[model samples]
Target: MPAEADPASIDAGAALADRGHGHRNEGLAKLAVGAIGIVFGDIGTSPIYAFRETFAGHHQLTPDGLHIYGVLSLVFWSMMLVVSIKYVTIIMRADNKGEGGSLALLALINRVSGNKRWTAPIVLLGVFATALFYGDSMITPAISVLSAVEGITTVEKDFAPFVLPLAMGILAGLFAIQSRGTEKVGQLFGPIMLVYFVTIAVLGIVHIAADPGILIALNPWYAIQFFLSDGLTAFLALGSVVLAVTGAEALYADMGHFGRNPIRVSWLFFVLPALMLNYLGQGAMILSLTPADAAVAIQNPFFLLAPESLRLPLVILATLATVIASQAVISGAFSVTQQAIQLGFMPRLRITHTSASAAGQIYIPVMNWGLMVMVMVLVLSFQTSSNLAAAYGIAVTGAMLIDTCLLAVVLFNLWKWNRFAAMAMLGIFFAIDFAYFGANLTKVPDGGWFPLMIGLIAFTLLTTWAKGRQLMMARMREAAMPISIFVDSAANSATRVPGTAVFMTSSPDGVPHALLHNLKHNKVLHERVILLTVKIADEPFVEQETRCKLEDLGQGFHRLIIRYGFMQEPDVPEALKRLTGCGPAFKMMDTSFFLARQTLLPSSRPGMAIWREKLFAWMLRNAESAMEFFRLPTNRVVELGSQVEI
Candidate 1:
């Protein structure tokens, strides 16, 4: 779970210039736009559920005017305190390299701890949280689209017949677009999300002006009253309510792309306030309306609160906003899975590149299909947006709780911030988030089993993949011919073909998986066989003066290991450029990057049990490929695919 994030180098321009682009500010801006835009979708759509579920989720509060006031009060303060204060204001600064996510946080902890003692438990928890996140990703679009489309049912009772299918169709369309990278589509996300906020705020304001007095739900008393009156139910209600603020984790995850500032400004100045005002307005309407009108109002509460003439346009705006929310969650799943694979928590798979310039833009065909299938099943099985809401928050709330724990480590252990100050701030966050987490627990039996089951399956797969890699690595090391011996032997017998072939490896002392596979399959060896391993030193960028070490073995076989800092991409080409003067002159056009492609096959050996083998295999088949992973040139890259039973 604690994957090393290759922190973004401040000298991204230097790397880009070598690659071709002279100035990278354009690419950087595009990256910022797409990444931040795609990331905000899930959290952006919370208003759809946050307020509605607070008043109507599993532990349904009375639709009475007073309860609505209390619920809205809880929702507004929760956003202000939990989403704005805890995350956007304070936690966004806790970034590793430029990368943000649970795994990134885990890496930061490892850097601070300076030991492997916390690795096992912390990593397991992070991977499980990531797996659960996929469940959230799948369900987000389903519920958002369903909830918005169900608006038709409010206008026409017969529209209920087509709501579920229509929602499924929209979800299917959304997933289908995964084959197309978000670079083009993502350009519109920020502005669109901005519009979504404005549209919802305007709708809320129209209602609030009609009944402005209900704005007093801003009082802390109503929020307290709800908890006192509903007792445990109010606490349980907090889980679904917290869904309004679901994207706080993504805010951290995408910090590197947006450089932490734009997102902070966007959330604090625009997104947060708009969301709160809308929720407050919803509360105001709910509090003023009679109980007899409760069912009717909530049926299209968001629209019902609006004037009759503007209702149709509001529906269109809501639908577009819902689409953006769904899209963002889907993209986050891709980024997280990529990190998981790199960290050794997941197996290898066929990841494809959809865009040329945007390295972050990738498409995983298997994952896309898998998500589509799950979303379809969820829609078909649940049969209603409200039912799907039951299962939605547990994974999201659980993730938020995990983030808090990770933040605690960052503040005290990493930053060495004062414990008294850190603990005081974190304690308030812990209480509020845990309360929401407890609220989500009430939803488990109702419909929350889905994410838990997915998390368990995912956790098992992740654990198995990690353990299997460890055992298999030990086996490979044991079976590997020592560098001195293999070179001595191959120096005499192996055919020396033209040009250089660098086999990037995990360990330079042992023979690479790709070298062995190439020699076995094609029965050809490059004239110069360079076994290269990139070691990460604890710095931002490794200096050229001491970037690499080259050992000249007998004949054409040589061993090279490049050392980098925490904040640099593993540019095989760049590393090759630095390796030229050390004895073997590497020519870019003439050289081929031989990469080992492991097709995971779960074996009943010391690595992974049979059940876990299936999970690892499934994960491998769904994972992104090594092509884009190592930033190798497509034509010059040769993949030696081999099977490893985990």
Candidate 2:
């Protein structure tokens, strides 16, 4: 040995390490509990409708021992393979700096690959996955809430008429409460869900004890046997079976909120066990009944698992769980919208930070109201959870297939995993994803057309906005004069003014149009002129120390580039407050912010269709103002209008 270790120091170091480990374990346990409430809500609530739909849905399956066992086996294995292995184990590892989602994963791959020939298609796949998620988001709330409320009919038939209105009212209330931050309400989620999980588990265990034989469905052979026996029917049943694993994507998407270990711990140890037990319990109850009773029981097997005295309370508990599940999906929508905006795939909508402590806790009023309206319409149109179930699987399966495609890219390209192992995993994922997607295709005429339509519309809007922004930036860049040239001429020609002026632009290399407009109209240059560009990087967060960058130009001119990660909100005033190396400190009252509002003109351009160009124009016109998005001092801001063609 180079030197003898000090025994006391070694003991001290070991004690410190132990303390750190203890703290880490405690944190993980707390986060895992939180993850159970939020991350697993969607999938957790699936047992409410998933089993019922497989039998009572559009493609009705017989609730006999064979079919029941087969379905149960399929559900269990799907949870194991899709949710546990694919998402919890493999896909969660692909997080972008602890952030997980299609956009984050896409950014990670883009940054690593660096303009490979195949990256363009991968990007499109990721965008389409995001698009599909929107459709899924809309359906999730409608179906989840509707299914739970439908349980009221099982308790009392006269409560049936109130189902639609009651569900609608509950949804409206849920949406209405979103303006207030969820941080306070989020605290209770874990405890309430903990109770719910325990209650459901107890109900499952009671039924499981009645006939421990139901445990046989846990075997994969039963699943394969059903496919072998009833090939086409089994294939079509997958359309409904896929609903069991509907929220698997949410696990990976929400990894940033809760760390990978917490989510994994929650799912593998608590959520998965509880869900499988409940599903198995449902199958057991059906098996214990006669054909006639089983037929009626299958219509509402999950609630029937509880005794007559407790059915109503069971319904209430389930409704609460469904509400929590819907809340999680709604929050996910807001998060996704924020990511899309920062990633430049969407227009900047007004975003309200709801919680002072939790930066990620935000409320998007437009998205909330829009989703509310859409969900109300869906509830009104579909009228029943079974009917709504028909529209559900396509978007989810499509998104899953897209995720598999993305995962394939991650495996082969980014991780450079062993070729054989990667292919084997991908082969299984693609097969399952494609089979589910193909089965859901049969649902198109029944109601699957809705999500496809939504996905198409969302895809068109997203792509149009992205392409239009790119073209607009290019046009602006082409027209802009070099900053060095502008500084050389304007510094001496213009009369110097007293205060600082910050001209906002998309590009760092050129003079901003607002600056040009300010010069022409005001006929003066500020003593301290800052040309500012806010850049969103291909990451989730930029450390504060490296965030602000300043470059000095001659004659009191400076170019400021503030880099923000895709998940971060751009706040110019706050950023400027912390900025150093820029000659003088910025004062809100003394600094004037300049922004250019671009009005797009429809041009016969090769870039996009005229219709898409018009759509892009509408989106641009409706986007949140730069002043608001950048959190500038409103009183000291100037807006200049310019017409541009792409």
- State the C-alpha lDDT per candidate: 0.72, 0.89
Q: Please, what are the lDDT tens digits per residue for candidate 2 over residues 327-444?
A: 9999999999999999999999999999886788899999999999999999999999999999999999999898999999888876679999999989999999999999999999
Per-model TM-score versus the true fold: 0.86, 0.96
lDDT of 1 at 325: 79
List candidate 2 segments past 4 Å from native: 1-26
Clashing pairs in 2: none
lDDT of 1 by residue, 584-636 (tens): 56667888988776676656666566776676566556655556656777888
Error of 2 at 315 (Å): 0.4
